[model samples]
Target: MAKIEPGNGLTSAVSRNILRGTTESLALTDGEGNSFGSDSELNAYTSERQTDKYGFIGGAQQYSEQSAENIPPEVLRQREAKWLDMLNNWDKWMAKRHKKMKLRCQKGIPPSLRGRAWLYLSGGKVKREQHKGKFEELDSQAGDPKWVDVIERDLHRQFPFHEMFVAREGHGQQDLYRVLKAYTLHRPEEGYCQAQAPIAAVLLMHMPAEDAFWGLVQICEKYLPGYYSAGLEAIQLDGEILFALLKRVSPLAHRHLKKHNMDPILYMTEWFMCAFSRTLPWASVLRVWDMFFCEGVKIIFRVGLVLLKCMLGSQDKLKTCQGQYETMELLKTIDTRYMQEGFLVREILELPVSERDIEKEHLASVRRWKETRGELHCKALPRMHGAKAIMAAEPPSRQDLRQNPTIIVELPLATKSNGEDKERKKTKEEKNGKKNSSPTPVVADLEPSKPPPPLKDTALLGSNQSLSSTEHDTYL
Candidate 1:
């Protein structure tokens, strides 16, 4: 387990001073012509210190941290696999194992055992019949070449620091492009999506291209159902549910947030969407990936909710909306105590029934909302507003106020105005039943005679180099 220290933000002197409300100051020279240090022999004449561990003060210690990467590759990595086996059987082993799967994964399955594991655990063994002979058929089509352009758009930006993805016109980059391009050709409906990046990066360490491509296909189709959809609306809804759980469990933090106008999007969004890849330790992250292969998307929600419980107070509410998109920025510095609790895994497995019960609640809430809509005369509210009106609108058999969540979650005095006050602005216009701002110029704008241009996805992978870029651009 990698150790992490807590204390939010940069932790430098400048940040500490700002937190202390101190004015910035700097002094130059001995203006009074006196030495602050003693002139005694030892104090005046010692040599500069040299130590390996210290960092951040710009001496030998600082130099070492910046240069740690310069250590021989053998140091950061063990050399046991120098001329290792060239195939993988991990997936087969993993599928049959009952325990310590996370342990076996980190010891680095040798190359000989790597490819098969990548394929089998990928759920690709079952897909062999479905995709085995398809690449050649795909290449025979005119559009086969076009998928390369799309593949290129995502790969270089996926894990740009890795040798396999260094944004170069080289063998590794070309091999990645070929596999993704072939996969896209093989499954046009699921042509591509951002989910494949970390998956591909992990596989490239062990498996060859062809096998890895099939595994990627299996992961998307079998494990993540809404894998390639635009805007990821399905995943976003899961986020809303996760946020609701966080509020219920950590209400004080939740209330503190409402006081500060923070949305859960400020921290929990990426933790759910990306499964804490950037929030937890890298090895811990691999543990998640392994379980993800075994259980599917439900584990993502479960593991994410568990991580949110683990990282309780570090979540800040004041960050801007754009800042909420990734977890790494906030998580890299969260105190280890957040994840250090010894009871985490058991607690997760034993999580409160209410926390993980969203599936049942979602449908019930939907039906109740629809029932309320049918009985509009009870109250005038939006399609999904007011638990009471919704309950009243439902069938007579379901009309008890005790069965309704609005009464349970809120007092009976609740009307729309009070229930939403903590969550929304109590604006003068909203109170007066008028629009807050002037209406947009609803001028007679003619619809275009021809259809508009096809929508393009510009969320090309890892580079925040620019948030949006099209099919042809490259960071290089």
Candidate 2:
């Protein structure tokens, strides 16, 4: 096996051949000793596999069906144990063991535990419980007819290679429709956006429809709020931020792109909006989502920066590219072999970028964008030309709070055993002179003051407790 060192360009024919061979080794097969030659072939084979095995009634197979089997047994056990521990003592684990959690997330959440872990990490469980039956309520109503056609058209386009979304009327696509429609009803202001389709599809792969819906809500509201809204103002602003970060991180590549009059929006809109779902390999996409849920949107920016550097950093690769079209083509079709899941994750984790760094750049970028807006006579920005600009001047309103309910653990006002209600009824009867009844003794409640019981193995599998912000904010 040959090692392709970082910074060594992939322009060499030998290196390219090695890369191609490695990629083919990971390609999907038709289970009859045949391999797919192209993405369409792979999709057709997987869709046929789904029909042959489970018919079209259930969800199609996931993109990376062998993802779990590829993990070493020892690693799998270790991750499973950690997942169980997190489940049993979720609050304490999230609060105290977050560094360990982040490290584990970087390694990769086990496929079996990914849904639960993501629900916990993204505060989805909290939101789900808070808005119980909300999806049913939303699903009962028809969404804005305007978004129905757009959502339906983009349904199959998301993860067309994945078995889950292969059939237009498959369980996966039906669930996807429900989730997207629920969201539009949940947040009528934002309605439906094309970029959200892939995001929801990926979520459906990991969790059920209702859970996926809440996960999407958490993402749009907490993780990347304004990015998918009508105007995509946040995305436009982040494009400038990404460009500024690129200039700092890879000045040479930045200069090359600028020289050719290439704009950040030219290549980064889908990348940012989809959170790399469409850009990275399915395996890499899962790993990135692990970190994205734990750390905020900074992960997206960092991954974007690293990708830019990988594609355009090498002088050898850039020298051959003549102009914006060539550069854009190169970027759009960058080889995934170079970005193998493990290597790409390691690179992203090792980057010197931080949340604080992104925040600083974001502030500056917003300022620059505002200045540019002023210069354009306060006209709609170029990015807003095609997209509707719902959020034009003011910041996103408090009404967004309604879209994603805050995490609230509703404690019972009084325990049934306490008989507080009984005592109230007795007092009212005595006041009315309707009956003479003894008042039930009030039991002093000490449960609130008592420390939580030690976690036991028996409690590992069925914990439904929602972690407080104290547990989440430390790392996220």
For all predicted structures, in order, the TM-scores are 0.47, 0.67
TM-score attained by model 2: 0.67
Per residue, candidate 1 scores C-alpha lDDT tens digits across 95-166 of: 354244433433333233344444444545435434456655553455554556555554544333233343
lDDT of 2 at 240: 80
lDDT of each: 0.40, 0.63
lDDT of 2 by residue, 1-476 (tens): 02223432223432332222222222433344233334465456655554321122122223443322267877776777667567545565555777787788878887766876787677676676666678888988888887776677556555544555554465666778889999988988677877788789888777777888888887787677676654455666778888988898899889998998776766787688778876676677788888888776778888888888988998888876889778877886776654567668878888887767777887787677667663212122223110012122112323321222222333344444658887886687778886744444433221223423332333212122222322331111
List clash counts for every candidate, in order.
12, 0
After superposition, candidate 1 runs with Cα above 4 Å error: 1-115, 139-150, 247-249, 253-275, 278-280, 314-358, 361-476
Instruction: Identify the leading candidate in terms of TM-score.
Output: 2
* Residue 26 displacement (Å), model 2: 22
Q: Residue 236 in candidate 2 has what lDDT?
A: 63
